[model samples]
Target: MSTWRIRLSLFLNFFVFAILLNTVGIVIKRVIDDYGVSEAMAASLEAYKDLSIAVGSFFLASYIPRFGYRRSMLVALLAVTIASMGVAVITGFWITPVLYMTIGVSFALIKGAVYSTVGLITRDQGEHTSLMNLLEGIFQVGALAGPLFFSVVMGLHFSWNQTYWIVALLSALAYLLLLITPLDESEVQSHPEQAGLVEMLKLLRWPLVWVFVLCAWLYVMIEQSFGTWLPTFHERIFGLDKHIAAGMLSVYAGSIALSRFVMSYLSRRIPWLPTQLTMLGGAFVLIVSILLTTAGWQGTTVDSWVAVPPLAWVFSMMGFFIGAIYPTIISIVLNKLEKPRHAAMTGLIIIFSALGGTTGSFVVGFISRSFSTHDAFYFPLIPITLLALMLIPYKRLADRFHPASPGG
Candidate 1:
């Protein structure tokens, strides 16, 4: 198939997969209502999904090149399709943990392959980052649409489980599309000397890899915290109905998608440092705003949803900045590594990102329990600060080792 055909296939694949991956925020509310789980218990679902992704990535990272990207993604799509169908058919929400575990494992396979495939297609750093932004933008589109889709189904009085049926069908279609698109995996660089378990582990010894890993972990933590809990946050703080709460979550995802779409264009015109630093600065401002608004909510009474704090909008819209960090970091990391180790490095990225997602969700739940839901909003500030500080080192390391010149 043509290059554009391949990109289209991968784009659609991510679009559908995102709906499954980003459903945690809505599911948090569903499990609470349907299964009568506590807030912490409901939040534990993220650990199930993310920990499984980490484990799957660890086992499959070194072997993805041998398995071939196209084959691995097909299997991943099949696995998620089956799992979603099972979840839809199962009664009650007791099957939730198992369902998420299945989704997590499937995502690990798809992501490891997908990240590696980007390196194969792009000719240089600029192309790589732009493409990553485009793909992530598409993924956010799915994230944006997912909550709205959930709200519609629930508003129509359908059982929440029926939502998985939509996921299953979309995943199955993505599978067929990928199957038809031919991928030239033979073009992906491989080194016979660095194609095994020891070689992959050796990547961990590099300080730069650890830096990228930390960056990935922290970025995902912020992204998933909002993605997984924003709906509940709105519902609780604003006293919004289930559909409205979920719809507001879509607004957040939509902001991220919109920003990413803009970044896909702007990244080509602006230098990487300026574009990234500007987004981080925006995040710092918005997060501080969110913290201030939530802290001062003590004497307020919400007589109607309209009386709810507008900071809730800031909390959701912060995705504009949060969206760029992860993909931009992955793009930079991929540019730094030799192509031979791209698959292995991509696995590490997913592993740390999984770790971040797991930790962020749990921490938010813990803080909410210990203090209040508003207090949990403060947890992201820690990573946001660390992420901003780390960029200095990341830039220095990048310039020293991987100059923007082609084949650096």
Candidate 2:
């Protein structure tokens, strides 16, 4: 089978979803201004999107191998494409949640298929880690471009809703590419009877899986806190123009993309645990420094990047340090499991990740509304500290369970 075509299709599918998923921050800002929604109400968008992801992944993910990876991805693309078109034609605050619900459900299928497909395409643990990083790196690229795409669209005198038309076009293109791509799932499909919700839920029986789940959950909480709110932070905290605030998220996404690409190269050279720990430490220091320096600081209105505070730039760099953590942890867990179990395991991961993202965004939104944006930024410190502590045991368990696995 030609793996490159399948790989390209996966990349395109992931890229499309990344843009739609990460645009929550920008969309949140827009709904507040255009629809007159409050911060807490806007935060429900995350719940709409993420809760659907959790529900979809829980029900559909285990069966994906039998349903076929290619078919699952194609279905996801088609659904999101239609949803985007619907949002473009229909304009209202009510429609926004509907669009995101579509996006969330569709992403569950796309992500489950992509993660499982990586196992089929790769030959070994090292290859798995490298490909995972590259795949996630591409996701970050989409994340980086998503805000910029919105900025440019709005800059052309188009409303944010019109951005969905372009997204619909992109989804159509990805759907076509995936429709033509061939993926061989015979290995995973061999025991079709074993793929079930019961078996998938059984993954939680293992202590390692539980610990890993907590880690995944905490990591995403931290990630979504920033990913879903940075634009709002920049806009409100720094008093920047909305477009500039939204565009500034590119810094965060770009840093993450760069870090993941770098990790793709370095994963082979460095130990995963130490590298992850070091990155967490760096993130901890930077986040603390930003919190201290920006405390009680009133932001002045800034029209351009030149006037944006240097500390805001420092805060964005948190992405660079944390970017590699998710893929690295995923690679570690999946590398230890047999290929047949990859889809089920990935389903479990996605479920927790979605829950984490939803919870994190809600908490931050509450904090920002109740307290202040600066206070909201401090929420990540708890997760960061917990994730750092969790890594030690996770590393030990990985080694104990799979002594010879490259991920250890």
Candidate 3:
């Protein structure tokens, strides 16, 4: 009923969504071994989910204001709840694409609605960034739990399909919680421009929007590549057991949550754009160093701290830096626009992020399938470097357009 209650409900819903979203990564090896699909085939699952999100968001985003964020979220929750059940009941590898597609489309609605609502609730860019970071931090905690939870379910003699039932139950609970809460769309400020397909197209006219789009795309690409493929990389490169490999991914996911938690506070003191560029630089150097070092190591083992390359530690911990980029950029973009455009811009944000995710998974999968997983690490280096470079121009644009709250 109250504002905080709605925000709380959103956090819970996003947490549930995060688990289901990350499952593709956790289950990739299982899909490969169970279904006999190649690495590329398993990797294409990202495309199914992300492209669905992209297409769905592109088409459905403008309608959020008309349908109301609350109603759209209700539909999204119910849809995903049913879809998760479908995942459990459905049999065989052929169902995988359908399962991912259902989740992707449902999430498109949920994300467009929730992000739009956030812009409504927060008073200014500072609060917006903080709340966004906190919400995403909760999502990362769910991601951190995903692989470990999947491994636990598998170890208990449960089928991987059973994981969907957990998602189903969580969604059901989130749906019920939201059912009772009140959301006031009128409290939100409306954009001066008319709300429709035309207005959505008009947003692309701004050069700043393009920069944010590319930045969002690059960040998600890197995030998904690591999120979707890290388990397979560990298992394939190091010969670790599935459970161990999956558990290792928690490091990456956990760092995201931890870093954002830190950023929610650091945002109060540190300048955002400068800090972000420095972190990206560190990430580029770390990833390149890992690739070179990994090539020289004859055999891979997860046996001991001393045995493994420092890459694993640095790579997993890279999430600390990467975590703040997305939410911060989202805040930056939304802050630049009027209230009416927030919903559509959020959709565009999802669109590029989804496209980037699809491209990242496909590229990494193709490279890993054709060459080695180690070599696939080279792919992200370009994006990382480019992201840092793009930020220089983006900072100028933000300062020029929003002088009062330049970094917020």
Which candidate's lDDT is highest?
Answer: 2
Regions of model 3 farther than 4 Å from truth: 25-47, 89-98, 187-193, 228-243, 291-295, 300-311, 362-376, 402-408
Cα lDDT tens digits for candidate 3, 264-346: 77776778888898878877887777767767555555655455545566667878878888888888888777666777887
How do all the candidates rank in terms of lDDT, highest first? 2, 3, 1
Candidates' lDDT values, in order? Answer: 0.79, 0.86, 0.80
- Kindly provide the TM-score of model 3 when superposed on the true structure, using C-alpha atoms: 0.85
Better of 1 and 2 by lDDT: 2
My TM-score estimates for the predictions, one after another, are 0.84, 0.87, 0.85
Clashes of each: 0, 0, 1
Clashing pairs in 2: none
- Return whichever of 1 and 2 wins on TM-score: 2
Residue 342 C-alpha lDDT in model 1: 75
